[model samples]
Target: MKIIVFLGPSLPRSEAASIIDAEFRSPVAQGDVYEATLIRPDAIAIIDGYFGFQPAVWHKEILWAMTQGIHVFGAASMGAWRAVELGPFGMVGHGWIYEAYRDGRLEGEDEVAITHGPAAVGYKPISEALVNMRRTFASAADAGVMTVDTARQLVQIAKRQFFPKRDYEAVITAAQLPAAQAADLSHWIRRHAIDQKRRDASSLLHWFSQNINYLSAPKRVAYQFSATVFWAQAVELKRREMLSRYPGRKLDHARIEQFTRQTMGNADVQCRQQRLEQCKP
Candidate 1:
């Protein structure tokens, strides 16, 4: 069975591959899944994705993949968020993080967002995920590493920081815990911190591996995909990008512009042209 997994900082590629043998790609961005559908893999598992710095994978593309009979599974970071939003539409969600979002216990992307290094460094995390910090604080409180009040204070501090700057050291410093207690909590965290994202990501990979046989069969969905003008534009952009990769493949720009105008209507076309002109220096 052919399966593709979009993965990144939530878990290392080597660790995930050890759990499930599949074609693993870097964190998914806009149009990535749509491009994957061209390959018609039996199933696709989304564990991590790009946002903020890049366009995120679109829900329309995922629905389109399902309409094409490809099974879609989501969990961990971006996957968990998309799964909760698209579950009723046929996307299968797995792991505790997915459940947390589905049940409304978690409501924001900040819970999963973490700053990380480039893919060349295996997307090394430079900041802690709020979800992991929450879990770790709770665990520390249960283990008597800190008081329940202290744990709650830490959570609040972590939540207030922007995701890119959220980390244990910052939270602990902001909380102003006693020096000895701070040292003890830090030591405990280094030893027993719960990496909820990685755990959920691994669960997703394992679940996909176990169900590969069943997933090999075509997926059936109850909804029909509607290709709106935006989706068409995305498709056209992808086509042009693919064509640009080959030499001597001349593009008919005028024809493409005509098609765009027809799909987007003259008013929208004019608005886009005005915006383009405004950007000129």
Candidate 2:
């Protein structure tokens, strides 16, 4: 069965590959899923995805993929969010993070957001996710490392900070706990902090491995895909982008022009050209 996983800082690619053999791509961004659909993989699993710094994967493209019979699974960070939103549309969700979002226990993007290094360095996380921190704090409290009240306080503090600035040290320090308690909490976290996103991502990979046979068949969905003008434009753009990567390949400019004219009227084309020219130096 052919499967593709979109992954990044939620878990190391090596670790994920160890759990399941699949084509692993970097964190998904806008147009990435549309590109994936062109390959017609039996299934696509989303673990991590780009947001804040890039255009996020569109829900429409995912729906389109499902309509095309590609099974889509979501978990971990961005995947969890997308799954919760698209669950009714036949996008499968897996693991604790997905459950939390689906059950409405989690409500914000910041819950999974974290600052991370580039892919060159393996997408190393520089900031902690609020969800992981919440889990860690709850675990610590349950273990008697801190009071439940203290854990709640820490969660509030972590939530207050912007996602990129949220980290263990920053949240603990801002809590202003006593020296001994702070020390204990810090030590406990070093040894026991729960990486909910990573765990969820690992679970997703394993689930995919186990379900490979069942997932080999195309997915069936009740809803019909509506190809709006924007979707057509997106598909054309993705097509051109893919073609551009192969220098030796020829582009069907005549067909592209015809498609452009059909999807985007002459006036819209002129307006877009004007805007592009205005941005030129």
In candidate 2 the C-alpha lDDT for residue 43 amounts to: 91
Q: Per-residue alpha-carbon lDDT of model 1 for 157-228, expressed as tens digits?
A: 999999999999999999888899999999999999999999999988887767667786798999866545
Q: How close to the true structure is residue 23 of candidate 2, measured as C-alpha lDDT?
A: 95
lDDT for 80 in candidate 2 is 92
Question: On a 0 to 1 TM-score scale, where does candidate 2 land against the true structure?
Answer: 0.89
Q: Could you tell me how far off, in angstroms, the CA of residue 249 lies in candidate 1 after the best superposition? A: 10
Query: How would you encode candidate 2's per-residue C-alpha lDDT over 30-144 as one tens digit per residue?
Result: 9999778766689999989999779999999898788778999999999999999999999999999899999989899999999999999999999999999999999999999
Stretches > 4 Å off in candidate 1: 245-281
Q: How does residue 60 of candidate 1 score in lDDT?
A: 86
